[model samples]
Target: MVALIATAFVQTGFAQHDHATHQTQSSALLPLYYNIKDALVVGNASLAAAKAGEFVEALKNADAKIVTGANRDGLLEHSGKIAGSKDLKSQREHFAGLSTDMIALAKGSKLSTEPVYQMYCPMKKTSWLSSEKTVKNPYYGSAMLTCGKVVETIK
Candidate 1:
């Protein structure tokens, strides 16, 4: 039975597991994530750093049981890097990595309560999440605002 269960788990791609059907606690991440993204969109380094710090704190306290293995670890790692940086450039650079992990977590854990849009910038080859479908390029802020497209919508 143990072997059978393990085999079933292997047959179903673990990272692609449908979390919308399961109960998870990582929705706690959305508000801080959106705030950090907004701060970066306006090119506010200090606010971004503060938001990132809160992001990490909320992540630590989040009931992340739905997120397993490397996904959870990568999220924490990237969030930590963002929290440690006060420079907008550095924070934005690290934010891409954090967004990557966050996207994976959102998809795999279905932790988002409302709709989340996955936006991408072909110019920078980076993607970020947004609460709305409208394009808001956090990577470049007003310098190149609306520079990206919505690639996916997580419901």
Candidate 2:
């Protein structure tokens, strides 16, 4: 009985350690994600595309244990689309999908020490993750810069 209890405790410790490692690994993607979002907010298609490409590479290089298979694939697909396109419209469209997957992932896992805001744009009918509480619409850029509201905050 003592041996069994010892084994269980050891397993629990490993589980906790794995979870902490996963959180750290997952949080690494947030900066890259923010880079793409910032590029979009400025209406810079070339920069957005470049950032998206970097994001794709980061996603691919991320620890596989950090994200579920479906979520990772969704991220890869949307970011890949954005990376392959230089048109602002196309990049923004793909960003919507990428944001969806990112929001889901961020919601499930602790992505940062600070609160991460999930903003919603009624005009675009889409949501995105932001490190800031202030709204800066990436979909319409400066045209509707402050067009969204914080729908949720992931701490």
**How do the residues 17-116 of candidate 2 rate in per-residue lDDT, one tens digit apiece?**
9888777778888988999999999999899889999888878877887777999999999999988998999999999999999998998888899999
Q: Give the TM-score of candidate 1.
A: 0.80
User: RMSD to the native, candidate 1?
Assistant: 7.2
Best by TM-score: 2
Best by lDDT: 2
| Lowest lDDT 10-residue stretch of candidate 2 | 18-27
Please list the residue runs of candidate 1 whose C-alpha ends up more than 4 Å from where it truly belongs after superposition: 1-24
Model 1 / residue 47 / CA error / Å: 0.7
lDDT of 1 at 14: 58
TM-scores for all predictions: 0.80, 0.86
> Where is model 2 more than 4 Å wrong at Cα?
1-21
